[model samples]
Target: MRDVSLLAGVSRMTVTRVFIRPDHVLPETRERVQRAVLELGYVPDRAAGSLATQRSGFVGLVLPTLSNGNFAAMVEGLTEALRTAGYELLIGYTSYSVAEEERQVHTVLSRRPEALVLAASAHSATMRRQVAQACIPVVEVAELPDDPIGHVIGFSNYAIGRAAGDFLAGLGHKRIAAIGASSDGERRDLRGEARLHGFTDALLAAKLPADMVRMEGDIPFSFTEGARIMARLLDEAAPPDAVFAVSDLAAVGVLMECRRRNIDVPHDMSLLGFGDFEIGQQMVPALSTIAVDFDDLGRRTGELVAELLQHDDPSGIARTDVGFTLIPRGTTRASVP
Candidate 1:
């Protein structure tokens, strides 16, 4: 910073002001400083700046996993939004474990971030308390919480599940099976559970026997897991007429497996999935699934964090429900006799 300031013919304070409040500096002076910074490849010490101002200008982002395209997209959207606001994102992956999430939270909080954005609904009461004590803006993205720590900018997983189940039942799929993530690490499991309950109840209400319902697990909400479960079910003497995989990745796997086995989708079996990721549509037979507005989720989270940061009174809580839609495509069809 000192070298850049010298090269730009400005004081160190001028350079600092350029970053913190560029609007205060003359256009020519700002340009000269920026050019000097570029020429010298000099990076300002954001940490030092934070110490001086007590504002980190950084937002801590904690996600359950980067493996899922859905979460990855959400992160991308979030980072883009944060960057536009002149804030940097400090990211951490927790692999969906509450303990791991708590540990990551502690590590991120140590950095004194201006705000925090969590990908999943937190499970640990201790962790929740810790975040509250941090006294920073905390926003939970992707899934709605029963008790949000600060602000929420996501949808109800329960509603997504129920919607998927209702759509499948309305299509007259009497014997429905659900393939879901078996890991207890993520609150996403609650989505699978809710979908399962909704599917079963909807079927039962239609006079379909509860015994007709089949479920399989030991998956991590991926395409590979979905395919594996479908293979196991197909190997059985009586396969389900329709199956709902909790994730689009899993549904794609199911579709691939059916193709390999020469099983006709919506003819021999129907499939439904969640997330409605891009891959779902690119497949040979497009997936029928529940779609969450991940981009909206990201934007809303950013807005909520900004609100919490600017407000003196934290008493007002904002819960934005980014709703879900069921995309009916080629995968699910009317049951065949």
Candidate 2:
């Protein structure tokens, strides 16, 4: 800044304003400062500037994984929204562990983000307390927890599972099954478990057996795990006529494995999945999926964050439920015989 200001024949404060609030400077002066900045390759030290402004100019986002397309899309949308609001996004991945989630939350909080956002809301009590004490607005995305720690912009994972179950059950397929991640250990996907529970509830409510509902596997499960789990289901003496995977990643795996085994899908078995991934659309039998507008959810959450940061006083707690849709494609037939 000092070098650029000297070259531009302006004070250090003028250089600062050029980057922080270019609109405040005259067009000719701003153009000169920008040229100097470019020539010197000067980079603004945001950390130092943040001390003077007392605004970090960034929001924190925690996610289960970065590999998922839906998650990537959501983050892209979130970053776009935040960028338009003059903020950046700092992200951390927890790999589906509650402990890691707590650690990442603490790490991001220490950075003094204007707000915090979590992709999933299975927060530990300690984590929740820390977030509350951070004195910043918080948003829980992709889930509507029974007890939200802060503002929520998400749909119900349980409802998604129930909808999947109801749709499959309504197809006259008496023998139905589901596969999802088990939350028995600390490294868990609690949202997936909630979906499984909802699926179970739907099955029981319809007087259908929930025995075929297999709750086993781990996070980041796609083709290998999906195929592995599906193989187990196929070995059963009475294999299900239809199956639902908590994630489309797993559903794709199941579809590929079925193709390998020469089993006709929706003929010998029907399949459904969640997360409406692009890969599902390109699949041969184009997977049927429970779709959530995750990217839109991220954008909405970003807008909400910007809105929350505007007021000094804590505003009313807001909860937004972005619902899900069940998209039936070639993989799910209208009926099973």
Candidate 3:
């Protein structure tokens, strides 16, 4: 800052004001300081500045995986929302592990973010304690938990699962099945598991056998695994006429596998998936699946955070349920009259 002031022919206070309160500084002076900063490649350290202001001006966001486009969209919306409030996002991915999430929380907290937002509500005991001790606002997004640590802004994953099951069943498909990750290791997708349970209950309610719901796959399920799982599903003695994938990526994989095996979709078999991903919409036969407004969810979460931070006394524990929608495209069949 001292060197920037020297280069801009201004006092250190003028340089500081240019970065902190540019509106208070003259336009020409602001331009000079900005030019000096650019030439020196200088970036202000919010963490250091927070020592005086007590405002870190950044929020920590924890995500499960970057591989999913839906998560990416959420992050994009969140960043944009935060930008207007003069806050930035410090992002981290946990690869669907509670332990990793705890580690990430610790690392992010070290930087002293004003708030923390988690994509998943489930956390390790240590992580919960740590977050509580930090005394910062916490926001849980993507999945609404029964007991949230702080504010909740997301749809019910279980309801999405149930909706998928009900959609397929309503189409007159009696033999139904679902594919998602098995809770085999410490790494898990709790949201996917919730969907599976919801789907199971929905099937049982309709008096359809829920035994075919196969929860066996890896975390962050992919297109390749979807195809492989679909192949195995077809080899069963009593194959299900309809299948629900935990992800749209997997559904596309299933469609590809069906084509390879000369199976006609919505005729010989019907497919459904969660997440209304772009590729699913662009497929030869558009995918049928559950859709959540993840981008909107992120934007809302960010807005909530900004609102909380701006006020000295925030309102009560807020809960916003954006809900889910079931979209039936070419991949799913409706019962004939």
Global lDDT scores for all candidate models: 0.78, 0.89, 0.89
- lDDT of candidate 2 over 198-238, digit per residue (tens): 99999999999999888777676677788999999888899
Estimate, for each residue in 86-122, the C-alpha lDDT of model 3 and write its tens digit.
7899999999988899999999998899999998657
How many backbone overlaps does candidate 2 show?
A: 0
Ranking by TM-score: 2, 3, 1
How close is each model in CA RMSD to the real structure?
A: 2.3, 1.6, 1.9
Q: Put down candidate 1 lDDT per residue, 42-100, tens digits, no spaces.
A: 88788788888888898999887777777777877777777777787899987667788
- In Å, residue 336's CA in model 2 sits off its true spot by 2.5
In model 1, where do residues sit more than 4 Å from their true spots? 184-188, 210-215, 334-337
Highest TM-score: which candidate? 2
Look at candidate 1 and tell me the lDDT of residue 33.
97
Error of 3 at 266 (Å): 1.0
Q: Between the candidate structures 1 and 3, which one is better when assessed by lDDT?
A: 3
Q: How far off is residue 237 in model 3, in Å? A: 1.6
